[model samples]
Target: MILSTASSSQANAAFWRFLATRLLVSLLTLLAVSFMIYGLIELMPGDYAERELFRKYSGTGVTITQAEIDRVRADLGLDRPFLVRYGEWLWNVVTRLDFGPAFRVETSVNALIGDKFFYTFVLVVGAMLISYIVAIPVGIWVASRKSGIGDGVVTLLSYLGLALPNFAIALVLLMLNAFVFDLDVTGLVSQEFRDAPWSMAKFLDFLGHAYIPLLVLGWSTTAFQLQTMRGLMKDEMGKLYVTAAQARGFSGWPMLIKYPARHAVMPIVSTIGFDFSRSFNELPIVASILVLGELGQELLLAFLDADQNTAAGILVCITSVIIAANFLSDLLVAALDPRVRMRGGR
Candidate 1:
């Protein structure tokens, strides 16, 4: 045993030690990510204030002089030193949970992202669940059947799914809905429920419109997971331990799952980390095609409009989620695999 005792005391201590290390590392990573995002936005040419001024006055009635633009820039804190601005932003976030006000929209970054975060969460989470549900059995079936027609069909579909971009999938679904189904598949909510207050009707309406995006996002993820699971299962089944078990009359699903499948599934668990990040990163293109006004779409617009505060906050939020997902996956792997636990996450 890695611990001094074979008792609960040793197990509990090891778990706590692992958790504490994960938390500390997560915090440090978050800080580094925030700094990088802020610094990169600062490096972008021109200030938001200048952009706003040009937008307000360019080709419009008023003429913005250089002096006036400079004054506006100062007012918007663009005149502040890079280090000073970054320090203030970081301090505000740590102390007050403030992400500052977004230019053009004139709302706090929190409010802008808060309004849309749930929908993004819903889309991503729903897709992830669907992917796992479809992938697991399909992967196992393909692995077990190996060289059979069912395996061939799954391989073909997986390859196709991986080849197609998400937006292409969304576009195809939209075309299908238009020509055949007549289902409401365009946006995140129906027109009536869009501006309406929260109600059961609105909630149901949201689900009704969510199906297509969910399918598009889930399909690619399912394909990737299926490929991964199939490969891992095949490799584990070929190992000496599995061959030894088979020689002892262990066979069929029980033996497969009891021994090899457990090890095979580790990669899938670790993949949960990248899967979340992939879903978030893929959202912008998919959301744009579907006209879903979630955090992904909003963040894309923020970048286009040079809305630095909103953009920064959204980036930070997404990065934090990715980091948290990875941390959770680490914990799950340690818990599931005794080898990993013994190694203390290496």
Candidate 2:
């Protein structure tokens, strides 16, 4: 027993080392994305100050002196060579936790993150909760039925979800809420209410607006999970070992609990981290339809109308969020799967 425990502890330690290595790679990828953002910003047809000049110095006497533009560039650190600027930005970002500041928005980049992150978290987490709650039972039902009528129904449902876009789903739900349910979801809180605070009223109001996101995201994945699990179960059930278990009078529950489900769970858990991360990307479409004051809508605005600085800050925040999600996913998968430890793959 001691020998087995020591071996398991050694294996776990090695697994964490592999995970650390994988995280280094992911961090490098994020750094590359940041560099790309910097390059593109530098490559913009005009200086970063050009847009601000137009907005601030609008109509008459807009003939800005070249020296002034150069001064602005120097202030923004844009006068530096692209590589130099990128290195400084990367170093400052990673070490000092300074992503600089947004040129357009008055708020600090980190402040902006704090403002919108909770909403994004609330939306995505709600959706994920609903997906699992619905998907798990549906997957089991389809697997138990195995190529029968229930499975056919689950397959069709999955296809329908896979076919529909989030925007389409959100829009349909919005129209229904407005026209049919008359829910007044536009106000995330009540019309009389204004802020999100810890209160029963706020909690209930949040829940009211949460359903559309929950339903759209949850329903989108149910089908895919159902199909994946069903196929996995089918494959496992067909194994010679499983046949022997059945012949030895092992019951259905034992076969499912001990055999197929355990084997099938690795793939599903592997995807959960990805799915959770993907929810952030999908936030904009839902935000657009519902007119929610969330990060998705904010990000779209940052890219579309806000200046380069604002967009860059948003991009930085987004990149950080994505990297964190991916890292968490890797850790979750490592923890969930023993084979992952043996293979030295995060």
Question: Each candidate's lDDT (Cα)?
Answer: 0.83, 0.70
Instruction: Report the lDDT tens digits of candidate 2 across residue range 1-346.
Output: 9998988888888887888887888778776777666667566577656666666787876688788878877876667777786677667777887766665575566666564666677777777767767776566556766477777777888888889988898888888888997766763556554544557887787787777777777777666776777778777777888788788888667677676777776677667657776777777777777777677666655554434445555666666666666666666677666777766664
Clash pairs (backbone) in predicted model 2 = none
Candidate 2: deviation at residue 174, Å? 0.8
> How badly does each model clash, as a count of residue pairs?
0, 0
lDDT of 1 by residue, 27-73 (tens): 89888877776777777787687788888888877977889988987
Candidate number with greatest TM-score: 1
Candidate 2 minimal-lDDT segment of 10 residues: 301-310
Question: Predicted candidate 1: what Cα RMSD to the true structure?
Answer: 2.6
lDDT of 2: 0.70
